[model samples]
Target: MSDTAARIADFIEPLRVAPGSKVRLGRDFDPRYRAGLKKREGVELLRTGVALLAEYQERLAAQDTYGVLLCLQALDAGGKDGTIRHVMSGVNPQGVKVSSFKVPSTEELDHDYLWRYARRLPSRGEIAIFNRSHYEEVLVVRVHPENLVRQKLPERARGKDVWERRYREINDWERYLTDNGFKVVKVFLNLSKEEQRVRFLKRIDLPEKNWKFSAADVRERRHWDAYQRAFSEMLSATSTPWAPWYVVPADRKWFARICTAAILAHTLMDIDPRYPEVSEEARNDLLAARQELEEEAPSGAAADPYAARTAEAKDEHGAGHGRPARKKHGRG
Candidate 1:
């Protein structure tokens, strides 16, 4: 790896939650961790990372053999939207799909918890970004058991151990995806309670951001300790070798976005997707097409005006021998 890349790798290493490791969120992960990067430096790194990410995305689409799923989970105002906007800004819109999961629709409630997410999985050669994802089943629902009642589970499925079962199920599902060509990348934007409070106040104070602050957000904030416990357990239980969770420091938006971009770029680097190689027949076909285009160029007008009148010819009767007159548009 280049020095820059090595530095990025080191920067994000601490964010990953190792599989089978116990997690005490406030004790272990620091929400303000910046990995020694200043604001301007982090922004510069993020810009570079986004460019590299775009190149990898183009190659990934051309390769057309693997897909990537980025699952982003966070509490209210944890900066999931900004992180997605910045981290994936440079990628092709055609190759990346961002799915932000809000409250479940009536139709969504009829299916399994993972069903909605399953239906939106990325096709080969594409990247899917899940803004909240199925992890909410454990995080939010676990925090508020009343929310679980809406799922309407059968008598057999209901138990104190249901969360544990869901964890195992999620781990297995992610493993299954990895067993195939799809890779699952999970990230949790770790925002401190105080930082979240500050952000919530900012939203309330700013007219432009007022719409982002909901009364429910403060209501949820009242359950901060409960949510933190849920997040801690969720991170500890669901993080696996196939789909480990990266707890990004979300207090500093610049550093968080930079770390998020670095982690994604590193994964693409590890995947090492490349543009597809052309076969001999395809190469010949490309060359033939190139030659045909060259023959119709303005440079060839001197040799055969009729054949090369492709640039800007205005003919009253049009070209003879079934050739059409050229009408140039802006760039053409």
Candidate 2:
């Protein structure tokens, strides 16, 4: 790796934290967001990493022994959607699936908080993406507090303890998934509040993007500091070696996407998937099938063997005829 690439890798490494540890989230870690990547260099790195990830996606699918769970978390307008779009554009859609979590359905609320997420787990040899995942329960609910009452945990524990317990539960659940066969990669698109305000305004001012805006977004913005605290705490509590969070600086959209793609490609490379080996008998059978298809006679009205014969005979007899005929026309 080049020095820049090496530094990027090292920066992402600390994001792989163990459960119960503390993590700091924000531009404090990456002060040079916009200055770090100019457009051309950023796009080049993003394209390169995405291409590698596309290959890794196919390899991971072929392996059939490991699956990747990519979770994306970010404040609104932090470029989570853009990261998924640009960074993962090269991956084959058949092997990759994206799940966008909104407010839980009544049925989901009835079950364990992790039930919906567990059901969406990637099958063997697949990549499953969570747009906004179970982390919301701890983050949003931790900030809003009132949201916890809806979860119906034991009445006695429905306070700060509830969020803490959920954190422990999530950590244990993730550990279980990792031990079983899942490679989890969580990314928090860390955009500055100023950038977020600009994006929100863009959505409101542009008629095409107006639908994405809502009064609720303003409500959430009021609790920005609270949400940040919750996010930091959640990251610290749930981040593990097996499933680490990458805090990608989102102010520069291309930079964030490239970093996220590189992280996933690196993770998938570790799985080491390859094409299945064929036996001698299988190879022979394949060759026989090919030969049979090639030797098959044309049938029904579609058969036109005489066409080939006519063309061959005409070519042998009339090689010079067309040239002379064309010369006479030109002379005339």
Q: Distance (Å) between predicted and true CA of 294, model 1?
A: 1.9
The residue-by-residue lDDT of candidate 2 on 127-208, one tens digit each, is 9999999898888777877777788777787854777788789878888888989988888888787888888999999999
Q: After superposition, how far is residue 36 of candidate 2 from its true place, in Å?
A: 3.2
Q: How high is the lDDT of residue 199 in model 2?
A: 86
**Residue 109 of model 2, lDDT score:** 83
Clashing pairs in 2: 17-239
Q: List candidate 2 segments past 4 Å from native.
A: 1-11, 14-21, 26-28, 31-35, 293-332
Candidate 1 lDDT for residue 35: 77
Reference-based lDDT, each prediction: 0.88, 0.79
TM-score of each: 0.88, 0.82
* Candidate 1 global lDDT: 0.88
lDDT of 1 by residue, 206-240 (tens): 99999999999999999989988999999999988
